[model samples]
Target: MVSIFLRSLVYNVLFYVLLVLWMLMAIPTFLLPRRVFMRVAKAWARSSIWLMSAICNIKVEYRGVEKIPNGPLIVASKHQSMWETFALLQFFDAPLFIYKRELGWIPFFGWYLMKSRMIGVDRDGGMRSLMEMARRAPKEIRGGRQLIIFPEGTRTPVDATPNYMTGVGQIYASAGVPCIPVALNSGLFWPRRTFMRYPGTLVVEFLDPLPPGLARKDFIVRIKASIEDATKRLVDAARAEQAQLFGRVPAKT
Candidate 1:
């Protein structure tokens, strides 16, 4: 706990200070060539990830990145860690992130998000609200952007039970875009409500996108199962890898 607190303190100072400077940089992005803004911000995300990895002693391993396309596809990811958010920003092309609208109220960030026109959902939203998402999503995709959606809705704890939300299914059906299910073992190290990042590798694996033919209901069910199965595999593989490091085999996922 002491380590967690101290690390959080140090990280907050470093990150927020940088965030302020980044906001100033955003002014030019709003006016001049947006590519310049993206370039600087992308570099910042990479540097941020590097620093966090060092301070938290956590590493990330990715597979099947080749399967990811360069268009406006919907991403259904398991929500287990905040690291995934910042880590994702490192992907440069600037994906259209689907998150709660409330995040848009966070000082300069909210302003930045508003300027960027990032999609932020309101939970108390009506049908018109989702219709808006459906509409904006396609336009963004057609304009060459990826949408990152956490179908589980929220983060789950490491020792807590996990469940799936139907939003992912709705988005795929409504948006009529290819959906990619990505699984990561981040919860093992990046537990919710804690800064005590563990020393280990978070494995992110992307399965192939859902093909047409299946109805929306069946598509949803299959996607939910696919993500869970991939997550289970990562958990088992992480345990096995750790066990091997200690000269033993893990029992189960």
Candidate 2:
């Protein structure tokens, strides 16, 4: 317990320090081209992943990376932990995240998001917000940027009842691109609102893409099925690995 506490504490401190430094370094990105800005942004994510492994003893393993198709596509993922927010950036060339509008208010961070041109949605604005997101998404998709959205909208504990939202379907139908479903077991290790990060492998798998032109209902069904099924397997596998690593199974948080 003490070891875990120490590791988590060190990770949190070092992680935030790196974040601030990266934000400072990213100030000049606003003047650069979009692709250059994305490269800078991905460097931050890569460094954070390195810190997670070096400080917290949590390693990440990605599967089915080859399944990611070229060109503009929708990458809809299961939201279980904050790790995916940064870690997933390395996978795409120029990825645009469908994130909350309030995130655009944070000082340097928000400035970076604006410069990066990430699509922001006002969650409380009801249907209008989703419509706005859908409206903005196609522009980016047409510009050859991959749209990364969380179908669940927010993070949930591993094995929690999934709350898949309609916004993803809206984007898929509007963007007219392939939708790649991503599943991960990140929550079993770096859970929400928790300082303790367990030492084990975190798995992220990109499932086959659902080709464009499916009806909204069918798109939603396939997206949910692919993510939930693979996510459940990852969660179960992580728990089993945790049992072997720590000598006890970790309860879903």
Candidate 3:
């Protein structure tokens, strides 16, 4: 526990300093010729992962990396830890994210996010805001960039049955493109709002895409089932791996 605190403190300092520097020069990096911003951004994220590994000893064991694409795809990911955001940024180039509006107010990180043109949905307002998100999302997908949406909406329960939201279904219906359901167990080590990152592997599983034959409303159950099923599989995998690594004797594989 003492080691975790020390490591977290050191990583926080390094990350904050890097974030400040990243924000100050982000615009030019993003606007420069040849669209080399993605190159710089990927390098930055790779370094972030390296720093986290060195400081916290948190090893990420991701799978299905080949499924990531350059074309417009709706990435329906299981929501758990916030760690995947950095992984996504590093792996994919400027893929638009659908997060709450309030998160945009976060200090240096939010500034860089805004300048990068990531999308934020207002979760507090009434139905109008919801409609706007549903409305705007399809257009973004149509524009050739992929999207990363947490099917559970917000983060899921740390140790309870998982339930996915209907918005992901609605988006799949409207977007009319292949939506990949990805299952991740990032929360196992990097629990939400917690500074202590346990040394373990984080698994990201890319499940099969939604049925291309189905229409919008058909996705209501189809997509939900897909995400929930995959989430369990991924979570189970992470739990098993964590048990073996830490000598905790897991429940089941």
Candidate 4:
């Protein structure tokens, strides 16, 4: 336990230091094309993944990447830890994220987010904000960008009940593009609201894409079922591995 604690401390410190270095190095891309900045962002994601494996003994496996289609689409992923927020960027040509508007107020990070033209919405705006996102999303989709959205809207614990929002369905219905459901067990290794990083396999599987033109109600139901079921399998598998590693699975907070 003490060894794990020390490793987690070192990983966290290096993670932020690496982020600051990447942000500073990426500054020149602010004036360049969006794709230029995107390339840098993807590099950061790869570097972070490598760092996790090197220092924390967390191996990452991405399955069904060949299933990702070209052109505009929606990538609806399970929300667990902060890992996927940036790690998933490497797979898409032009990735777009809808984030809290307040994050866009940060110094360098916010400036880069604005430069990349990510969608920012006010959390307090309620239905109006959803409507605004619905209105703007299709335009970006039409421009051939892949929108990555978390159906749950926020991270949940590995064993928590699933609470998927209808916002992703709205975007799917509005964008008129196929939606890819991604399932992963990231929370097992990178648990939220804590500094301890566990050692295990982190799997992100991109399941089959749901075709466009389904009713919003049906779309929501299908997406929720697909992500939750796959996520359960992933979490269970990781828990077994953790048991083997430590003689018992870690307790959920």
Point to the candidate with the largest TM-score: 4
lDDT per residue as tens, model 3, 52-114: 888888776667777665577888777777677767766555477887888899875665567
Candidate 1 lDDT for residue 137: 71
lDDT score at residue 37, model 3, on the 0-100 scale:
60
Instruction: Evaluate all candidate structures by whole-model CA lDDT and list the values in order.
Output: 0.71, 0.88, 0.71, 0.92
Model 4 is weakest, by summed lDDT over 10 consecutive residues, at: 166-175
The runs of at least 3 residues in candidate 2 whose Cα sits more than 4 Å from the true structure, single-residue gaps closed, are none
TM-score of model 2 (CA atoms): 0.97
What is the number of residue pairs that collide in model 3?
0
lDDT score of residue 34 within candidate 1: 51
Ranking by lDDT: 4, 2, 3, 1
Pairs with steric clashes in candidate 1: none
Q: How does model 3 score by TM-score?
A: 0.84
Overall local distance difference test of candidate 3: 0.71
Model 4: lDDT to the true structure: 0.92
Stronger candidate by TM-score (1 vs 3)? 3
Q: Per-residue lDDT of 1-253 in model 2, one digit per residue for the tens? A: 6898899999988999999998888778788887887898899999999999998788889999999999998999888889999899999998998777899999988888888898777879987876777788988897898988888878988878998888778778888889899999999889999878888999999999899999998999999999999999998888888899879986669
Choose 2 or 3, whichever is better by lDDT: 2
